[model samples]
Target: MLKPGGILLLTTHGDITRQNLLPDEQQKFDAGELVVRGNVKEGHRMYTAYHPVKYMNTLFDHKVTVLKHKAGTRQSWGLEQDLWLLQKGNS
Candidate 1:
């Protein structure tokens, strides 16, 4: 577990990254659900998953302090991600 008061910074695929997903996947994502793609046999980037903002926060729930949350602009290849800056809970 992250030490209490520890700062964690991370980026992940978010809504803006949904454009590349299929219709069903997009629907699931818009519904505040996680969406994943790629084959298991492929390399890391080839298999990816994204979480909805709502869902993402839920994963941490009351366990952390969200210092910042922002979505980046979509890239030329249609990739965009959300940034999260968090501080672990002291509890």
Candidate 2:
């Protein structure tokens, strides 16, 4: 559990998933309540989750105060990333 006023920083795949995924992947993302994908080429098949800005904000609404939310594409990778900074509430 987080102490009051503690800071939490999180990052996730952002809106770019919708733009960069293949048609089939996008279809699955649209249909699923929560979309998760596995990286097959990585030998250790790890799964990753993606979220839109609104959903990401909602996920933490009850626990913390959002200090910042940033979404943008990285120039080198050309992939969108969501960065969030949250301060834990006293509740």
Residue pairs clashing in model 2 are: none
Tens digit per residue, CA lDDT, model 1, 1-91 = 6898999999988877777778998889988898877774555556788888988888878989889998868678866678999999777
Q: Candidate 1: where are CA atoms >4 Å away?
A: 40-45, 75-78
Model 2, CA-based lDDT: 0.73
Candidate 2 matches the true fold with a TM-score of 0.73
For candidate 2, the 10 contiguous residues with the lowest summed lDDT are 27-36
TM-score of each: 0.83, 0.73
Worst 10 residues of 1 by lDDT: 37-46
As a whole number from 0 to 100, the lDDT of residue 67 in candidate 1 is 95
Question: lDDT by residue for model 2 over 7-74, one digit each (tens)?
Answer: 98888877766776668767655654345678845678777776766666667778789899888666
Q: How many residue pairs clash (N, CA or C atoms closer than 3 angstroms) in each of the candidate models, in the order given? A: 0, 0
